[model samples]
Target: MNNKIKSFLKSFTLFEIFLITIGITLVTTFSIVFGANPLAICSSVIGIIGVVFIAKGSVIGSVLGIIMSIFYIIVSYINGLYGEVVLYVLVIIPMNILSIIQWFKNVSQDKVTIKVQKTAKKDLIILAIATIIAIPIVYIILKFFNTQSLILSTFSIIISTVGTYLNVKRDKLTFIVFILHNLVVISLWIVTIINIQNLSLIPIIVNSSVNLFSNMYGVINWTKMQKKQNQKGSY
Candidate 1:
C-alpha cells in the first residue's frame, strides 16, 4: 500500500499538483457551504485524478474514469441534467472500459506507460461525420425531455463523442477535443447553477476548470512524446 501510494504520488508533476490543489480547494469550500454531498465531492476529485493520470498515459486513469462515470451519472440524474446522465451512462462508461482494454494492450515493456497513437485522416473524417449526425440526434432527444440548457447539452454530446473516440484510439487529438468539451461542460454547469442557485453545482464548475488545465497538460506532454518518437525514428 505504501509503495502504491508513493507510485501514485510520483506520477504527478508539480504543475499537476498545483492544478489539483486548486480544484480540491474549490470543491471543498463549495461542499462546506452547500451542505456536502459526499458522492458528488468524491466523484469530482476522482475524476480530476483520472484526467491527470490519463495526461501521463497511465492505465490506472482509465480505471478511475470508469468509476467516475458511474458516480457522475447518478449525480446528473438527481440534478435533472438528463443530457449528462445519458452521456455518462450510455457513452462515457462503456468507452472508458474499452479505453482500459486498449491502453493495456499499448502498455510499454515496463508496464507503466501507454503509447499514444497518431490519428489517421480517415478517422478524422469519421469523427466529423459522426459529430454532424450526433448533434441533431442528441439535440432532438434532449429537447424532447426538456433537458436543461438543451443546446449546450447537445453540444456537449457532440464534443464528448468525438473526445471519447479519440481517447480510446489513444490519439493526441483527444486533448484538443477535451479542451472544447471542457468549455461546453463549464457552460452547462453554469446554466444549472444559475437555474438552481445551489452550491452543489459549484464543484462541477471547479471540475470543468480542472479538466481544461488537465487537457492542456495532456496536449503539451503528448506533443513532447510525439517529438521524441519522431527523433528516435530519424536516428
Candidate 2:
C-alpha cells in the first residue's frame, strides 16, 4: 500500500525542483525585452510560482491566474486583440474565484464541482441582448471602445457584470474539459510563436522552455498540496 505512495513521493527532490524553477525564472527574466512591462514580468514570475506549486484546478492557481490574467488581457486589449479581450475580460475575476471554490474542500471524492455547463438559453439570450446593448452603449457609456481607456473600462465592466446573473451549477466535465482546454492553450501558444516574427529562434526556444517547465513545475506544487491535504486527514 505505502509502496505506491512512496513512488509518488519520489517524483520530486529538493535539488531537482530548485534547479528547474531557477532556470524558468531566469529565462522569464530575459523575456523582459520582448514587450513585457515590469508589471507583466513580475506577474509572470509570481504566476509561474503560484501555478507550479498549486494544482491546475486548485484554488491557489485560480486566484493567482485571475489576478495576473487582468494585466495580460489588458495588454492584449491595448494591442487590439479585441476578440480575446472580450472573452477573457468577463472571467478574470470569476474564474479565479470559481477555482477557489472548486478546490476549497477536498474530501468529496464521490463528486467534483469544478466545471459548470454553458449558460442556459434564456441566460444566453439575455447575454446576447447585453452584448447587443454593449455595442451602442459602448459608445455612450464608455467613450468609444476605441477612443478612450476610461470608456473602454465601462464596456469591460458591463460585459463582466451581466454574466453574474446566473447561479445554476453543475458537476465539472473534467475529463473532457481538461483535455480540450489544454489543447486549445497549446494551439494558442503555437499561434503566438508563429505571429511573433520579431523573436529570434533562440528567444523563442528560451520562452518555450520557460513556459513548459514552469507549468510542469506548477504540477509539482499541485501534487505537494494534494499530498498535504491527504496527510492532514491523519492525526
Top of the candidates by lDDT: 1
Q: What does the lDDT come to for candidate 2?
A: 0.46
Candidate 1: which stretches are off by over 4 Å? 1-8, 230-235
Tens-place lDDT per residue, model 2, 17-78, is 56447745665656655654455454455545444433233344466667767765764554
Error of 1 at 102 (Å): 0.6
Model 2 RMSD, rounded to 1 decimal:
9.6
What's the lDDT for all of these models? 0.84, 0.46
The CA lDDT at 39 in model 1 is 79
Tens-digit lDDT string for candidate 1 (1-235): 9998998788778988887788888888888898757878988888888898888888888899988888888888888889998998888888999899997777654467667778899879987887888788899999999898899888888789788989998889999999999999998888888997776767877888898999999999877766765665521
Highest-TM-score candidate: 1
* TM-score on alpha carbons, each prediction: 0.92, 0.46
